[model samples]
Target: AITQAEISVQELATHSGQIEASNKALDDIAKQINMFALNATIEASRTGNNGQGFSVIANEISKMSRSSHEMLGKVTSSLFRVKEKIDATTAVFATSHAEASRGVELGSGLTDIFEDLLEKANAANDSLGSINESIQSQFSSLANIQNSSEELATVAEKNAASANMVASVTEETAAAVEYVTRSAMELTRISESLSQSIPTAKMFDEWQPDDSNEKASQ
Candidate 1:
């Protein structure tokens, strides 16, 4: 819009120049008419009484020329004032255009800065989202590890109980073996005493204890 106003101001200045030139031409024509009127007054005076009408006509022509000259002077003065105003207006338009251009540049720069900031903000948001996902995944893995650890603890408890049962059974078997050994030694002593007290012991001498039972006792 400022550009359009500036163009219009320039066109107005051009038209003002043209109007001033035309006013100058009209002033020159008025001067020429005044000179012609003066020549006619001189000629009419030389012709004496016969030229009174010619003299009156020449005076009217002179009056009309003076009025035209005065009007032209006023028009020239007005044109000068209009030209000064046009020059001032043109300068104002030029300054406005410069300021407007600078404002546009500043606005564009601000827009670019805002866009950069927005892009960085979006990137930061994406990074935060990724970090959140990673944290969630790690939390899930930790829960799985905890479950596995609990299962391992349960299995260890069961194994310890089984070991204790085995140890108790082993102790019982050892006690039973000790009692059988004492019974076997008593039986051997009784048999030896019976043999010394009896004459038929010689016949029993051919009989022997079973080898399997002796091995088991040993």
Candidate 2:
């Protein structure tokens, strides 16, 4: 018993839209959080010693936001990732009418490992979404990062700027940091690509917003 491929196509389109909307929402949340830092600065300046406690809290939050900004930065740096998946999914959808949709087959040994990934993706997504909501402070510092690309002459220029900051903080050259970032990006792409190719994941083959949906392997 089966239905039309058009229905599946429709569903895939809807899912893709949802994922894009969620990413945009997260970006906006980041912007709002970044704005909080400005208010925090003003408050600290006004309150003086009283604001010291607030400043300390704000500092901790700024650190967290820095981390969040880095994480989102890394993700944005790889936006082409989701786009590739979207393209692949679109190809699959096009062929869904031409060929039978095959669910990945699981067997003796690799089953346990496959199950673990599915569990992790689900648990991470569930917890991440909740924790993301609960944190009001972490996004404050990242507000300005939204348009960093717009202001930047190039990624290399951004890297040089980061390099200068790193040198000031830790004595690293801008060129060195750029090398590190480029290598890191390449390494991450390779690793992510490898993980995506897992036979279990290849089955049930849904384009997830994050690895959190590994449960779809079910």
Candidate 3:
């Protein structure tokens, strides 16, 4: 369970990093769009009567670029918060896994102790005939050991149950990480699609990294 959680965390970290890079690229492209729009507006204004349509288009483009920038900013902030939560959850899972492993070890050790106690009890019974004078006292000791063993067994059962529950929760978390990975990929695709519609976007695309590493199969 610990190993699985660790793998999930590593994948989540990689996905988060890819999303961060894409967001940065989107932001850069949006800024360039805004700059182009601003220059177009200036040139349109200098053209007198013939530039009204161009000016209106430039104004709309500027507004769109600003809106895209703001939207990306909000998304980036949200992703940061999500990454923080995932980190916290990963820490929690790691702690739980450690505790569960320790519980199993302790339970196994207790079982071994109980088996030794039982063996000793049987040996005592076998020799009871020769020591009849102290038979009652030896029987009492055997009963106490038996009772203690039962209680220890019960405790071990409870520990096993707790460990199972932790494993189940870890599986659910792994599923959530998978969902997040898909969502991040979809966001990347949408960002790319949006960029293609903007003027001079190709230049910004050229500035982006190959992204092959980011898109490698999980």
Candidate 4:
């Protein structure tokens, strides 16, 4: 848009040049007309009273030329002002174009930076996803380990119970062996006392002094 405005301003400057040229041509024409009027007045004076009407016509022509010159001057001044404004407008457009171009370059740079940041963000998201998966896998493995540990604990508890049962049976067997040993000692003492008491019964013993006493002594 700025470029188009600059072009338009340049075209206006060209038109102003053309208008100034035309104004100069008009001024030249006015000068020629004024000179012709002066010459006509000189000829009218040379021709005396009969040239009075001709002299008045010459004066009117001169006055018209002067008016035309004054108008042309005003036009020239206006064209100068218009040219100055056009030049100023053209400068402003040129500056605006430069600024706009710079702004576009900055915008493009910002876009590239934003794209790079977006790519990095996506990569970060992918990395986080991978990390989350890894953590889940580790949790699964830990769960399996915990389950195995619980199974081992159960087996250990069963083995401990079986060991406690065996220890109780062994204690009962020891108690029974101690009772049998005591009974054997008491029986031996009773047999020795009977051997001594039987001698007091000599008469009966003699009557029965057969293999009984011999077997007992043997």
What lDDT is obtained when candidate 4 is compared to the true structure? Answer: 0.39
Off by over 4 Å in 2: 1-10, 74-80, 95-218
Q: lDDT by residue for model 1 over 77-123, one digit each (tens)?
A: 54455445445544544443454444433345433433443343234
lDDT tens digits, residue span 1-218, model 4: 32332444355445445545544654554454445445544544554564455445445544544553454355445445444544444454344345444443334543343344334323433433443343334234323323332332333233453334323322332342243233223322322222222112222212211233334545
Q: Of 2 and 3, which scores higher on lDDT?
A: 3
Which pairs, if any, clash in model 1?
Answer: none
Candidate 2 structure quality by residue, lDDT tens digits, 139-180:
332333222212221222334423332223222122323333
lDDT of each: 0.40, 0.39, 0.41, 0.39
Model 4 clash pairs are none
Residue 33, model 4: lDDT of 40
lDDT of 3 by residue, 51-136 (tens): 45544544554554455445445555544554454444444434434544444333454334334433432332233222232223
**TM-scores for all candidates?**
0.43, 0.40, 0.43, 0.42
By summed lDDT, the worst window of 10 consecutive residues in model 3 runs over 197-206
What does the lDDT read for residue 151 in candidate 2? 27
lDDT of 2 at 51: 40
